[model samples]
Target chain A: MATKKPKIRTMEELASAIAVSRPTLSRFFQDPESVRPATAEKIRQGLAHVDYVPNFFATRMNRRASGLVGVIVPLLTDPFFASLLQTVELAALEMDFTVITQCSHGSAELEANAVERLLSMNTEGVVVAPLGEYGSADALRQLGRSLPIVFVDSRPAEPYTTIDFVGTDNEQSIGLITDYLCRTGAPPVYLGMPRLNSNGLERESAYRRWMAGHDLRPEVLPDDLAPQSWAFETYAYQTMDALFGQGLYVDATILCANDRLAMGALQAAHRHGLFNSRPGARTRVRIAGHDDHPLSRFMTPALTTVAQDIDTIGMTAMSLLASRIRSGKPGEETVERTFPAALKIRESA
Target chain B: MATKKPKIRTMEELASAIAVSRPTLSRFFQDPESVRPATAEKIRQGLAHVDYVPNFFATRMNRRASGLVGVIVPLLTDPFFASLLQTVELAALEMDFTVITQCSHGSAELEANAVERLLSMNTEGVVVAPLGEYGSADALRQLGRSLPIVFVDSRPAEPYTTIDFVGTDNEQSIGLITDYLCRTGAPPVYLGMPRLNSNGLERESAYRRWMAGHDLRPEVLPDDLAPQSWAFETYAYQTMDALFGQGLYVDATILCANDRLAMGALQAAHRHGLFNSRPGARTRVRIAGHDDHPLSRFMTPALTTVAQDIDTIGMTAMSLLASRIRSGKPGEETVERTFPAALKIRESA
Candidate 1:
């Protein structure tokens, strides 16, 4: 008798009959730049026809020995930091690695302590939006040497020394805001936290330079940034009220240090009976902020601020950390990648 | 030869110089309460006078083994949580044990994930301010048998079986507020979360009970509990505006669910120009809230609120966890502790 033909199966029948190898069609899930465009398109269209179910865990594990990423942020209360933290968290989840986060909250000792704790836990690699201060640099380098440590949003004093840094160009971002205010209205008032304490020095210096280049006057308002400070929102509100009481004629636009201060300023304006929808309510004064906090879009008339590329920051950080972790590179060759910022024109501006 | 030469230090001399450890000093330093009040006072005074430093770490190590206490909260953005977290952190720091805090952000998966992560990190005990749902008593117990777990501010199902719990007496607190409103003016209209959420149920029920007992009309206004999910503040504000426009008699005391809702109500009132500063302002409606947030006192005509004993919650949680870690006794009975709330009478009331 003729040997019973081993049940003849076409490629479609074989792919549909067994669920294991469908995920091996990487050309299906990935984009054209990653795989051929025509091939990717064919696989994509064919996936629905064949009822493919990719083994995500298996493919991820096979692709890499293991996927583990660590993310660190300065503080969660600050809306900017919170937004950034949330973005990175979502991105890491998409990549299918368990992202563990720690908040340093702007304390050197606490930052160091968190770093040590993360190190003791043996995370695959770390992405730190660190408190850019003196003591943190050495600790960061040590951690970088041991495993991949990608710094985000802030960097150390010594650049091109060690580790990888990803951040928005602070000078360019603030300069754009100042230039917008000057164009739309009068010279803007720069309201910010104390200059000596943080990386805001870059923004403050940029603002001063921008004003000088435009041949305009600059009014800088710096809040005292003591350690373990009091309420920043209240501080901003009270400061603005005091300035107004002193007959300081702030121009139409106020460029805030960040969204937190701007929100506070809006609240202050409300309390002072400004910004109401009364007849002829529009004043020369306008409130502009930065970072586009989650609540910003919900605020009255929304907020006009600089939007940072959080997706890029997250992806770059992950890639840098993964490479360093795999290579175990101890050599000090720090990278500072600066991303441009875009002006998010909204009602406030 | 030294003994023969009488090379000895006198207690009087030592006490005068280092200013500690005489007849009763040792007991006071070891445990302050063990000594008589007068003796303890004298020891403290003498110690302060001499400016002596104790070997705190050595003393701590000698007294007990290293104990790990865990703290978990729903969100870190709310300053109420931040304030409580800080207190717990300080308490843990003083107790000389590590504290691992995880933010669940109202996610069950994240909550369980944090618990598992803490257990994997070998936490000795845990104190959780749970999201009031989806906590597994069995799995939590199985993961860390030796460690004592304490629930704070929210109780899980089967409390006596798995862990100790602590929170404020919500019913009595709300009842007191209700009584105060009825006694002073018209019966209060309860402004509460739209959803009958688990944690605030007691407060709502208490308000209802008080209203029924007094034979007063209970007008409960429902509000969006998940403020972040919707345009909550704005919705609440506009709803109140419409209520006013329809000649609604809202001139009675309004008891808000929490400080945040009260804040929105206050903004609405201000926008409508309802609140006044004249003697007639006394006749205007009053508003009060619970959970005295830091910003509560800063609001115009500072808010009247019930201040829960958050410090006690933290301290008790730490102590229970420490005890559980040290004993490692699965046979140990579970416990529950509730703290009283205090009504802070402020301007808005």
Candidate 2:
């Protein structure tokens, strides 16, 4: 016996059967709120009858803007950025915006290209974590004039008066951690990144200022030995290994730039037979870091760090961008907001 | 003196300046290969003279297909998926394809929504790490009929003959790690997840099979203790802590389903004063895991794990999808490719 094949329905037929114009049907699928409730209901009912799915490309062609937002980050593999992205995604979804995230892989060129791509898409807005020193100011400025942009985590070195910025209070966070490290143990030497982003520079300055305020000598590991790549753990591991090999900073506290660096230092200390306990005979080194990475708690001795309120950051950035998108004004005065960080003391320090 | 405003050029002006149609200019921005070399070069020179970026939405409206490929994963915060995503993105870029990645957050509904969004974007193809048992087969089947799909890490429960799949050889990997653990120390207790994905189920089965082959009783951790959330580390930490409080397996080795769980177990052991070294008086617990997460090497004892060849998986998946897209055949026979996992023996075991 022969079986009958299912009938295929075209989008035009579906729209006609639903008794609505093609543009209205397209608008309904793009966003239900776009079409009138009665027409949207008719389209929905018709959609259930036919196995036809609207072609997104064709629907987007009719619309002036796709209800899409672009989020560009310096790196996605970093737990800090990963957590931040998650928070932002949830927030964007709640605001009825679809987010398309892209990673720059720590390259300035890639960052610029990402912006260009987002611009091409006619994205409603963009939330970016700029590659501080390496980012292109001209490209950002040009793009900023065309759409709403919110800079998160770190702002561009050459600030544009029209761009919104959201980030943690790095100076205050660093001061809090440094004060704790000094009071609980020996004064710490600053181990910092190679100025990859503005946050590192702020933290380094804060560490120096705090040490000098306490009438102590300021010590920072030189940048000559810093790794040129974004693998901060490897850089910290090698730096600590070389420093330990020279019998430097034994029984001294070290304030790492971030949790990943602190993790590597802890590993280096463990390999050197140095215990990381606070009150033990085997204890040899004290360590603290900034940016309470998600995995910090799982570290062997746990880690002492400053926790950035990522939820607040994500919420603030989204709110600012949504407002800008609604206003659609490019000449508005820029707003910069900073959330304070909290200290999380654990066994490491 | 007031600054002189820069002249704004439109797509029409640029096209006329380059002596080409607007459609050709749009095609050049979408993909350079779509236009003849000489015309593309002429358009590039015209673009260099003007500070204009093509409207991607408008350009996409004219094209039959967007050069965008969708990549969907069960979770984005997990380092395993992050690593796999990085590999896939780089490979896709090499193939001149733009990648749009979305995370399902381990929810089948979210997975279906993600596929719907991709369909709306008119994505050329999709590489998905499905949500396993919870995923909607009907939604995937509908998407499969429209474009090529390559499943990564795990395949769907209701298999379709036209879809391609690429993943790690779970049985071989688990067997290799289990044999090493048994040979080196006490036969390890199996620590498994709540069967969120097929990988966990396969690892659990492989552990039981190996134990039976050795004529030993297999011990699998009960799933009742597993957390309902995707936080594997917390789940493992709580499970290990509870078992330790009961004085169960005080000195026995453990084989975790994945590295995140192993990390949690390691942290719990440290809290209980059980060291993780091969040749030390303080050594008490020996633990191993699978899927060598990026941070696993930075662990104090350096995790011993089965390293899934994520690069191979990404490359194979992309290659298969690209070929399928080129062929444009939904009725073609499915292809299944498995890359062998390597046992990385480190200090933990």
Candidate 3:
């Protein structure tokens, strides 16, 4: 026969068994700070004696801060955004903050809707990686009027407002990648979008200029997908396949628009059965991209990409937004802080 | 020279262009239903004529419901949870509801905190995938007392008076997997935690019983990591590697505890080069698991997993909770709804 475990009846019985009060026990559950240190100790001892465990949700209401920080991203399926958002969540946990995340699916209306919902909650503040499209800008500007909203990844063109901007220097960052590719080998095909308001426009322009400076002809792919519908792999895979069918010739190297697109390029290359490393590394086709997403390391042969400083971005954005929340006055100084990106040399390139 | 686009100022100017009053224009943006049919048309024309867009947050404020539904999960780093939560968000959007997602990190305190925050926002309701061990049952129950709270994936022993629940049929679903493995191949080595919650315990028990019924001895490799740590992959990888190194060979198949752990096992098997398919029609060391996570399809050779009926579960839970919300009464029946799991036969057994 199995031994039966005894059950606890009341707080008093449990307290008496360990040797502490009903009030103190309640206080400990409600707010840990509400009870005296000595009383808390006695209650802890009593709890062990009776083996009484309080209910899960009940103890939470007994505490404070609600532990929720609202996080809004452009999309969740995008590995780049997912990696950065995961980092922010980890940082929030370290600060004892629970994160409530939402993806706008690149819709300005949805972004605003997500924000309004977050505001309804007892969110300390919001860390938003917004879509730089015109609609989202206006929506963000409106949100800036109320809460301590921190803008991440996307940079709003309005230079007068003091919304904290934490992101990489897209132009300079991509320029470095372009320069390296041009210097090490023949200039690779530049894969990017064709939009003016897009922050990536700066990167594309930088690549063109860098190529021209090196006296190399630039081959830019034209893409018209809306920012909301733009997926890295889908674009890259189709475009690369098209390039292959068109009998486009390459110098055994490719520079992708982003890490996701690069991953797609790798898959395309693999489909062509071109993965063997030649003696002296001559037969290896080099592929590189930007934003070293967390999963980049796990990809086949890994990825040689540029890494963004998201830690500094998240922390600075939060602190800046917190100050604005406390001031009650909208900020005037537009401090556009840009974190430098570094090249990560891996198996791919 | 490029033609310059004209910009108009003031709502009245835009309204006049489309033959509408400023008040109607304002009302249209606030709530499209507030105006007459003709008036709404005129206002939309006014908006399009000058491209005048109203503030989303301010406009939504005029509505009765915020259209915000809170979604709380344990963490975002786990791809499986990330994918599940993403699906929930899509479903909520299809119902014209915005989602606010919070991560509990499998902590009871954090779960409670997220609930309090959601309440402070006066959210319509919350769908939570809680950490069963985290002592959040009471906090959730308290919320259930006043608000619509739906439990997803995890359920407390003591059901909430008003809260609704949606989850997979752990016992029956896992039993199906165990039965299949036992019939077709040698009883697999049970790899998982010694003591587990609903899903884990159900899968473990099914394995044990299936082995016993088939007149075979069960080999258990219980993980030593604490449940709260949320380190499923690390431990599974290390354990599988250790077993492989020790020359521990049993049946021709490996049954993983879950899809996530199965993913780790697959990676380990690949690393050791023992997971290759045979040339003939013979099954090559079958590997099967539960939970058809999103990544399961994309894996090399795919995966043979148990598919949970996510759509039915989500919709049922929402409808049940919504009824409770409308009636202003707690649900009478404690519904323990269990959906069957279907086997997805892929390359990996």
Candidate 4:
């Protein structure tokens, strides 16, 4: 018969069993580097031998900052946000913090509920990709008063004027994609995104501005998607399919607000007998998009789009939140960091 | 002029201000349904008017369950896992438990670290999509002994034989895809996934077994991708690109382990001057894959694959974990729930 092992339940008992002073054990838990690595290794091996885990409840009871942070995004099913959250988690781990993630699923009520969850978790700080105009200002202001917060990807309007933000410059990105299309083929017609988010409104205005700068007439397509809908693909497919019988985008290029829309446009084009960008056979309907989504490169004709720097955005937001937590203050002067987007020219445009 | 309101910082103060007994306020926080709707409304309004959140640490300090659950996955960047996690989070939210997510990013070491992090969080329970053969068995055993754990999507070998699991029935799913291809065209050649996890190994064996059942020779292409690399797209592209001049899969249908691989195969096929499944200019290479991934429908020659019911898998896993947690026992006779995969036929095969 196997012998029942003696259970070590507390840190003090483990320290005593391992023949180390309690303060040494405490310091090692606080920062392993505070003790020699040999001692640290001994502690680690001892921990492996027993089921004893350092109690996190003690940290919370002491009214000390829990080494927990938070992140809120609109949807995790969208590959773009999924990839961004992955990057943010990697950065958080490197900074020795754990991240609690929430997906609002594109609902204002859910977004507010997520804020309450963060408050309950006692998160040291948070990074939010706000749902633009649909977000609850009261909930956000309450949260802002309590903890360090940084916004990423999408911007919220005033009186969040002093909030820290990290994102791609839509004006520069839209201008770059628009200019590339004009140089390569017909001046692109703008296939706009849903008007719920700031990016949708900003990108359309940027496209018009770029066309104005070039002294050309901008044919703005319908911004007809319903409010708060994240289904960009369905919207683009429906819009393009409805217009296929009339002109098929040959007279004007189709520049989508994002790569997902371009993917949908490609699908509609394929269904309507507009072939691919193969060497021998190709479609005359040149299309472009922004945000170089993960599946963009796998598209049949591939997508020509602007690429946002997710690594910089994720790491910067984390580092900013880290500094704020370290300073132990709320409502610091706001800072903004904008990254320029780079054009990726593929077969489509 | 707006008058400055007195701050009601504690639960007792808020209860007094709202003219509710302390027990009523506590009951409302515990379960709003325990109180009258009108009383619940009053409490909700009071919470909204003030920045007072029920302290989670109080529950922890009482040595009560924290009402926090955890989820561990191999990668969130993979859309399959992203979609599955999204479903799991929804179920968790419905159960009124907050979820903390950890992505191991396909590393066994990271998976172990995540287990340790969960231990520190004192999670009531956790649902893990284990990293098949690459998972940390000791860490998992420790976790299993400490709390309720349910594995999803991938299976781990014994001494975990009795652990609760939810996944697609691989044998049935593989047979369906293989039978479809054999019926429609030349018997397919299997493009294997990297041998890092159980799904990869199980899928290949399932294909071989199905071929044996049909009395046909199984031609499994090399499972040559390096260990622990999640770059399935690049792997499939390189494999297909290398074999381009050697016949271009015309003699045999190319059946990939999953949709992402099939997507890559399609891209390589397109790059090699082979056209798409758009009406007239179709290529002779017929490709099929498993796992009707979210983007599988948008693939140029949209994928024909097996659809695992993620909603059933996710909800089943959560409910199992919830029961286990409610029972307050570390180990019980484990249960396994397997859902049959349905065939989603598209243009690819």
Name the lDDT value of residue B102 in candidate 1: 68
In model 2, the Cα lDDT at residue B17 comes to 72
Clashes of each: 2, 2, 15, 0
Q: Rate the local accuracy (lDDT) of all candidates.
A: 0.64, 0.82, 0.66, 0.82
Q: What TM-score goes with each of the models?
A: 0.68, 0.91, 0.70, 0.89
Q: Output per-candidate TM-scores for chain A, rounded to 2 decimals.
A: 0.72, 0.89, 0.72, 0.85
Per-residue CA lDDT of model 2 for B277-307, tens digit only, reads 4354543778899999988988877999999
Please state the CAPRI-style docking class of candidate 1: incorrect
Sliding window of 10 residues with minimal summed lDDT for model 2 chain B: B1-10
DockQ of candidate 2, scored on C-alphas against the true complex (2 decimals): 0.69
- All DockQ scores: 0.04, 0.69, 0.10, 0.66
Model 2, range A124-193, lDDT digits (tens) per residue? 8899888875456766776787788899998786867666889998888988998998888788998988
- Can you give the lDDT of residue A82 in candidate 4? 87
- State the lDDT of candidate 3 residue by residue for A148-190, as single tens digits: 6777887554543366677888877887887777677766777
Give i-RMS (Å) per prediction: 11.8, 1.6, 8.2, 1.4
Residues A131-247, model 1: lDDT tens digits: 766767666665665567777887654454555778888888888888887788767888775332334677777888889888888778844542234256676787777766564
Q: What's the residue-level lDDT of A42 in candidate 3?
A: 71
Across all candidates, what is each one's fraction of true contacts kept?
Answer: 0.03, 0.78, 0.11, 0.74
Inter-residue clash pairs, candidate 2: A56-B120, A120-B56
